[model samples]
Target: MRFYIQQFIRTIMMAVFAVFFLRLHVTGELARYVNPKYDGMSQLAAVIFVFLTFIQFSRIWKSKKDNQAHCSKECSHHHGDDHSFLKKVISYVILIFPLLTGFSLPPQTLNSSLAENKGTLLSEGQSLDIVQESDDHQYFPAVENTDKNHNEKPLPNNNYLQEEAYQKKMKTLEDVHSIDMNEDIFSSYYEVIRASPRDFVGKNITLQGFIYREEGLHSNQLVISRFLITHCIADASVIGLLTEFEQASSYEKDTWMEIEGTLDVTTHNGAELPIIKAKRGRVIKEPSNPYIYPVLRKMTD
Candidate 1:
């Protein structure tokens, strides 16, 4: 009977987990914890949970006869053992805590608090080139072509010229720098700015993020950051741009805001870093899906 009861408890826990994912899916909140590319995996887990639940029910049905056969006072006394009762209580408590907390509290994306603890990337301007190397290769692959005949020497591919033209056009747009930050293009914009901060200097841009103030920052200096999650929240890291706003002290830590500004280079602790000179700022609600996902392909829109 105790074994069947334990199985039933486990079944309930599995169902709870299954429902948790379902809840996130239905409310479009799954993107907060994971990239949208992995949404199918969550659905698959829910299906597996349902299958396991059926197996648990089958086991419970089969155990009914054995439970009746061992229904004597001796078995009852063993089932009521203090140590066994304590173990069962512990097991249930452990299983129920996550489910209760998940349902009771609202789901939130990583914010300034987590950014402060994990450390922000805006200060690490020197490492931007290294971070962007792989991304550059991925986005701009080499163009190659071979001559069809032995008499003909290999000629440069016209595709290379076209790609060069495209890059030049992109650079011209970057120079204009009127950037609009949204879920689709956030990663791409971040990569560009980090890779070559000087190219974007004096360009007007508007973006939104939570406030993150690192140690030793001046009264006018604060970071506007968003968590970049590759897989899930466990591996989330903060990436942000520094802002120079005189009224920074008026906003509380972790407050969400939309900032419009011009990108410029500034020296902080002898390190040349990119900072936004704020022209306008306004408080805004946090986005439902706050984490910026890495772009796997070129963002055309």
Candidate 2:
């Protein structure tokens, strides 16, 4: 009973923090402390937590003399009251394991886990490197070279030349916009980018919009977003393309740019790939909202 009371107090405190953590103004660090990812999985966890906490509270209440006295008349069994604390601990740990894992792992790490394999885990060290099937992003392990290595003679002073080239590349990219969206690339909403995942599975596509970051995903990829609303931007969820440009290094997240590229299909873990493709285009900064379209849950063309 005492253990249950202590658990109740801790759960209450966590619930309070979760409310504030999900608030719009909360910083990422604070939010992670309370709700971690705050994505669908985290939201589901909060719901389950609330449900289980109530069940525990009910059990704790039933342990009291007044509750037992009143409920005994209506019920025949209070078997859970006699359950050992070790059994309770084991049961709670099994039930709450998912929530603990969800809140503890970083969001991007979660993405990799979803995309790759269940056996994958964050490295013991602090490095951002992840274990993936390929080196699609910088944080993950390098991909194996698919091209066969011929026994060609090595270039003289290869290391020095590579260093010099890298330095020059860095100098060129110092002022480039991290994200670029160009409005002219796509004439109308439907005319350029196709919304159907079926039709565009293996084709090239382009999109332009303001940039935003997502948890459990790569940072450099542009989330070409458009606000869909039944009422307003508050309810305006984003539906757009997730792509890497052929010359994408110049653009920054949230910077506007018009992308011109081909469509490609990719599979992440078991989750459907979020319409990822390749493109070659110019990036240009502009106002956040360039097009005015009706906000619907799904885009139908």
Candidate 3:
């Protein structure tokens, strides 16, 4: 009887990877890690790992005749059998550590701390290229808001919108006197308003997000922010509107809220941007999916 111990360990590692990825999808935790649009890719990875695990399993058991033939001096082939003991231990530990962490620790939502770390409040036009593309760009002719949330085709909540559909969403938004920043178009629409704050002056608006505050914000002002995840949580960046209300200071950072207000011009570090002059607000529980992903595709890419 003969057994390839290294092959057995490799098989187990491959199986672990397959199961770990499957667990994330089965438990609905995958969305917390990546955009739903790429779920097919991750599921594919899991399938490949499963296939590799089976292939490695076949290598773990061989008859004495096969083992002897395989290990003969004339047939010498490196398959990790010559790895130094210390090298093997260190390499396995390095890999197993992250897998252990993934299983033992729950995934976390991106918080305002990440926003503060990036040194971007998303209020400035210059830093937005990191998380959002130009939505309205400088100046697009506006369309009348005949009906809010009405479109020739309803915008899919997926990661990309067709060019025509995207333009329609932005065009309708610009001409509207009031807006509700829904999750479907949050990131794209936000960049447009940030790009052309003057066009949206005095327009009533409603939005919801966790509270974010920084040093220079007035006592009446605090940011209502959401982390915008482009590819995955690792690439998340904070985006939101500056909001001012009489009782803004009563809410602590990271408190979830929904607020109604009107858009008005504000200067941040000498650049003009939109700020919500909050008329009324109510505290709300945090959303299950708190991240805002970019909605439109960059057809240019």
Candidate 4:
């Protein structure tokens, strides 16, 4: 009887897990806790949960029909060695508490308070080459009516090699100069700014994040920050850029805001850091999906 009861409980727990994942994915709350790249994996796990529940239910049904038949001497001996009542109760509590909480409370994004606790990663300064190249490559106007003596000495023997090198250089230059802080590339912009703060100096940027102020920050200094989660909320880390605004004190901590500014390099605690000198700022509602997923390759590397 106890075995059948335990199997029934296990089946219900599996169903709960499956339902939790489905609800998170359907409501789009999964992104708040984990990177979207892993959404497929979560769905796969949910399917597995449903499959296990089916297997558990089959076992429970089989046990019920054969209760008397399976009561052989060996079965009796094994059942006598079942886990203690206290241990069984503890296991059930461990499985049910999280499911209950997930159902009862609303999902939340990591905010400024959690940012302070996790600590921010925005202090290093590295040199970056900011070379700009025209995207359009048009052939230089062919020399017209040039003197024979100055005629472009039939193209060099390594002309193809030189052309390839030039194209490669132009591609690199284009990448270095491009910095977009829109929703699609917010995390990429953050990575570039963190990796090489000096390269972005004087570039205009617009982004939204909660205000975070740490001890020792000047009255005018605050951070515009967001949480970066690769796997799940448990592993979330704070990434932000420092900002200086005269009226920073007017904005309460943890308030979401959209800020437009120019990137500037500044010194803080003897380390050069990227600071956004805000030109305009305004309060904004928090986004439904607040956590930013760092470029996966960069995060793994």
Candidate 5:
């Protein structure tokens, strides 16, 4: 029974170490080992770690025989202080090396191999980029309402707001527009979280950000984007909300619009989807400096 309990404890510890190592590998925390830019010494450390994990597991099967050979019976030396201390030192070195290398990562220092697959980080200096890209981007172009009569006009609705868990702070049209027109969203590390089913699933939420169009979808449908900044603008990502108005056909792509709506769940192609059917939506003149939101892949990553 005592032997079984000891084996169980050892197995648990090994599992913990394995899980920790695997997570660091999967979430890209282990990029330094695979990076060509790392110095030779860094690469050597990685190879040593891989070798150590294998050797430690190898010792388990021969533990009794090894102990007997290393400690003579007449000497009565069990695997005593010196051996125990060495084991501890080896464990510490093995565990600490991987994490230490991970901590040395610089801002956006990830490999270029994965960079194209990742989202672009934006800053306040790139506000013009938002204007140009968003204005030029076409999600559903043919349906864009170019008719002067159909252009969006602002509607005042003091009672239109439906309370939510996450609320968008009411900023005056002037206050929102005046947020440093010269600065870009990337420089500000600004992010917009929306109250749409796509993000929060079923939760009611409010959103504040500039509108962007998706080409394959209906022409009037727009995606409201907000930057999700992690450490800096260079690492920013964009999050989106899908908005559809009953009179959606009346609006153009890239129109600056404010919308208050309920969360709606729907599907697109084969996957689940979210739709915000506006309770009230009105267009405002494109703000002098618009807030561009970043895209974060997963919240905890």
Candidate 6:
């Protein structure tokens, strides 16, 4: 038993990893950690962990003769018993900490308070059209999203779109009289609006996001913001619109709301930016999945 104790502990470690990853998938929480487009790879990791557990378990009961079946006993490579007890304990503790926390703590839903650490949705001179998707945004051609002209779809896992669907949404943007800014098309259309704020002026638009405020906003104004994430939440960027209304002061920060009004242009630092003249709005519950993903238009339309 002493000879195999380290082998037993290693086998248990591998098994725990397999269980942790598989549980995230079973409970549909894997999206909380990474972009859904990469789910296939994550699931593969869980599967590989399971395979390793079986393979490592086989090593625990092997006799010295069978252990040498793969490599000669003369092999110089390190094995389970190679390290001192204290060294082994320290190394394994480091490996175990993240896994234990992953199971013991829930993935926090990124909200307004925590989002400030990421920075303001837009800088004083930042133009929405200049906000390009970073390298991580490149995935499955075009992402599936919602627009005013189309029905909303299930989010998080199914956010990436087939090429056909993406083109249709792009075309819809050009032809629609009103814009519905759902998670799927929010970032894309924001670029269009800022690129030519005049073109969208008087256009009635609707959107939903948590309330956020920053410097340069009036007391009657706030930013309706969402975190734009790719791969992981830690790297999320804030994206939203500057909106103003008399009732804005009545609502506190971090309040989630759905609002509709006309799109109007405002000047800051002599640059034209889009601002929502909110007509009517109501507080709403926080979304189940609040993060907005950046999309890639794989094919030219």
Top-lDDT structure, candidate number: 3
Tens-place lDDT per residue, model 2, 60-147, is 4334555455564668766335778898777767656644654575432112222223322211222232123223422322222222
For each candidate, the alpha-carbon lDDT, in order, equals 0.68, 0.40, 0.77, 0.68, 0.42, 0.74
Q: Please estimate how well model 3 matches the true structure, expressed as its whole-model Cα lDDT.
A: 0.77
What's the lDDT for candidate 4? 0.68
Clash totals for all candidate models: 0, 21, 0, 0, 21, 2
Candidate 3 lDDT, tens digit per residue, 185-283? 898889889998888877988897999987667776789998888788888888889887667777789887777877778776667878887776777
Top TM-score prediction, candidate number: 3
What digit string (tens of lDDT, one per residue) describes model 4 on residues 271-297?
A: 667777776677766666766665433
Once fitted onto the true fold, the runs of candidate 5 whose alpha carbons sit more than 4 angstroms away are 1-205, 285-301
TM-score for each model? 0.70, 0.32, 0.83, 0.74, 0.31, 0.80
TM-score of 6: 0.80
Residue pairs with backbone atoms closer than 3 Å in model 1 (clashes) = none
- Winner on lDDT between 1 and 6 is 6
Local accuracy of candidate 5 as per-residue lDDT tens digits, 147-171: 4533444231112223331132323
Q: Per-residue lDDT of 18-94 in model 1, one digit per residue for the tens?
A: 88988988988777777777888999998898888777766654455665676775564544235666887987898
Which segments of candidate 2 are over 4 A away from where they belong?
A: 1-198, 246-250, 287-291, 295-301
lDDT of 6 by residue, 1-301 (tens): 2257667788899999989988988887776777767778878999999999999887677577665667875888875567788998899999899888998999877777766776666555543322122233222222123334233434653566668887788788777888898787777787788788888877888998889987666676789988777778777777788887766777888887787877778776677778887776777666666777777555544
Lowest summed-lDDT stretch of 10 residues in model 5?
123-132
- After superposition on all CA atoms, what RMSD does each candidate show versus the true structure? 14.3, 18.9, 8.7, 15.0, 18.0, 9.1
Residue runs of model 1 more than 4 Å from their true location after superposition: 1-3, 63-94, 124-175, 298-301
Candidate 3 off by > 4 Å? 70-80, 122-157, 298-301
Range of the 10 consecutive residues with the lowest summed lDDT in candidate 6: 137-146
User: Candidate 5: lDDT of 71?
Assistant: 57
